[model samples]
Target: MKNSLKLLLSSALLLTLAACQGQDVATLNLEGGDNIVGGSKVSSWSDLSKHVLSILTGPGERIQICTAVLIRDNIALTAAHCVYQKNKIRIAYGVDLYEQGNEIPVDKVVIHELYGGPGSGRNDLALIRIAGNLPRKYKPVALPSVADTPYQGQELITVGYGRTGWMKGAENDGRLRQVAVNVDSTDMNKIWIGRSNGKGICQGDSGGPTFLKKNGEYYPIGIASYILMMSDDPAKKCLEGGVLMNVVSYLPWIHQNLPSLN
Candidate 1:
């Protein structure tokens, strides 16, 4: 069951901890097709915390959960595959989803125009705007500028709500987790972070933010898109590099869609 569940979606399977409406964790399908992602659990909403939130997208029984970062008071950014279904989607605010937090209503979800539809992960980026103001703690994180480029050997910090162990369902606990991965390479479309000392991403981790620190503050440069699988074994599947949709490359499109962001 574990082997079958982990390889359900695309040939490459994009990534998302997508599950049924009531299930704790679903099989791997789209981006961040999570399994046991290695990272430290975040217990407090301080420093670079809280800026990240979970997205719950329901289109039929399939409920896709992905991580998104608040870029504006009411606007958040994530990978296109996360909210592509665009059904009854909502954003959950808090370090832990099952905890005492509110599932905020989303007013809008705009996927990138260039995004290839289902199974085509090209230009996988999107924006989500909620209906009201969020708590002050969930402040918006800064977006990278068009001119900005990730320096060589940049240490990127990634955050996700994905599973923490081989059998530990990422969304089963709904707690946020993080890891710092070094840049293996980057291109106009994506940033690639190789598996670090055996640590990488898994389900429930899609659309999460990859931050580049500058002047002591973290700036979002990319969002989770897919993981390069090296093995068919579920435990070793996510042991390769992780790919992120470069947020910096989509600045123009984002500005055009969300004019207020400009």
Candidate 2:
């Protein structure tokens, strides 16, 4: 979500906001949390990185940054909170925010009906239909089908434009970065990954993509939601792993909205 951690941490004192900013994932029961350890800078929209996107939301100087994944030429998937209750939402297709790329206007936004609000929600997923075609260099990632049972120790690849460090002021340069994490547990709506292993997420990453690799290909299986706090202070967000919205479980709803998905 654009406002992610830095901006939204101002909401409540020690609690209230559990998810990322803007989407403010409504404090989940994430079992484990992690850091963005061993992440490498992405220089191009090729390979698996092609599907990742940066979201510029809000208005004027307060425009917040977030991330998303393209599933079709015009359809992109993201966290509902990231785009919800916001304005002038634009989708940027590029590796770095400052670099040259296509920033397309969003023609349609499909936020989950179950989404609670900016400060809370159950299902955090959302979809964006751009007014123009995606850039030539950009490509969609493979999507998953029915929801799969999330087991402990399962590995996944996560990509987003969020803070690299967990601290409140940690640098979130709006660059495309990625990290690998393992599933620590699960519940009805989210898959918990990491827990103080020093690898996870912070602000500006909400609604990003978490991929499951199979047969030499990557498939988006999860959506980046929020960070579980390690202490009463929201700054302690990064130390805990993080929560991922299970994409498989939302396929029916997704296909229902973007009927062209299937």
Candidate 3:
């Protein structure tokens, strides 16, 4: 994640706002929640990293503002906030410098029209179509057929290249890390905790995937969205922890809008 983005410690104290400031992801207080949870890490493009893509704003932006996951053969899933007007956006996949397969570009991008919210729902998600078929080297992750599972206190894996440090200007890349977090039951819209182990998504991790560990496989669960309400007093400027969005809530929308890629 970039240094400019803001992550909230708790969702309860979030100040109701329309748009997120430069780096502030003002949603609701997310700290000490019992519903959301996470873990896991990936440094580069592997079987795991292949599912992870850098959602770059432009060809020469020099930095990834967020991360995303490939849900279908050529469809990449992410947060709608990552999409901006006239921005040169694309997904970088199969990024193995030493191997034959490397980066794959996105063919197009589509975000929900009501992502910013119509002032009622906290809708925030997007889909990206790559320019070509997904090579065998890169396969997409499976989405949950039902949202009946992944209850609060459940375990999950949070993977991304977000900044490792808490202060501004701190950054992480290539290398991925995983941390265990608990779920915030009340806030069905978020994934809670993760900071106790000194790890959580920030800045560049905006669109990264939060996977649920079940049986012996990982299922896509949440997409890192906005963070509202700081851990400490904002007037005192204290940074405590942060929160992430739950993508599972949009399962019905995802099924209805996703274009069949076969």
Candidate 4:
């Protein structure tokens, strides 16, 4: 609903891997089949249910357009691009947006100091503080430890309230979704994830979470950033792979800003 065409086109130019040489591969077009290309609808509540949040932009007739992850009862983490242009934002939790959920107003949005926007994808992280504490159902997710290491071929799960398919365009629909992707590579600030068995990130998934499991618990390792279109066909939508901002690399910055967490 926020007119993804502009964002998609702008991101297309930023996909070149050469620009990101030292950090990671330059951006490439996304390509794939179905499932998010292959993701499935989340059926019921789970540990991930409370930590994943839907971000709604605009006033009055707000719509779920992006995703965020809760790191505290009143704090959430998302991509810098998701909150950079707005003064106020709203986030929702629960199974369905229209049916059952809580829409919390965000009072403060803090974007990373180094974030350079669509072109560079540098420091593409943000933190949002809700005006008040949420109910117990909205639980905080753990951040990855600084010592945690990411390797190629590692399997990771990504969760969001984004589009199920690209042909129909972006839709909130109020349902949460999950997809599994494999880490293709990693750098100091970002991780590249490729669709595993057809599952990948879509248009509305920006600012979502890419989780890694440890000790039977899931920790957020990356923040959904951008997707690459795999095909040259202008008609194709949300085709192939995507990128996530590595959370572990920014722990010190996060701790500095969100002092309460310390």
- Choose the strongest candidate by TM-score: 1
User: Where is model 4 more than 4 Å wrong at Cα?
Assistant: 1-36, 60-64, 169-172, 234-236, 260-262
Whole-structure CA lDDT of model 1 = 0.68
C-alpha lDDT of residue 145 in model 2 = 60
Runs in model 1 lying further than 4 Å from the true structure:
1-36, 59-61, 166-171, 260-262
Across 1-262, the per-residue lDDT of candidate 3 in tens digits comes to 2222122211111221112233343443211111111334444444566676655553432323456787877887877666543256655443321132235566667777666542122566778788866567666788875554456667667765444443433433333445555555526565553455444554445667778866756677877664434543432111234455566667777777785433
Residue 220 accuracy (lDDT) in model 1 = 90
Worst 10 residues of 2 by lDDT: 8-17
TM-score of each: 0.82, 0.81, 0.71, 0.80
Scored against the true structure, residue 67 in model 2 reaches a CA lDDT of: 78
Worst 10 residues of 3 by lDDT: 9-18
Q: After superposition, how far is residue 121 of candidate 4 from its true place, in Å?
A: 1.7
Give lDDT per model, in order: 0.68, 0.68, 0.52, 0.68
Q: Residue 162 of candidate 1: its Cα lDDT?
A: 58
Model 2 accuracy (lDDT, Cα): 0.68
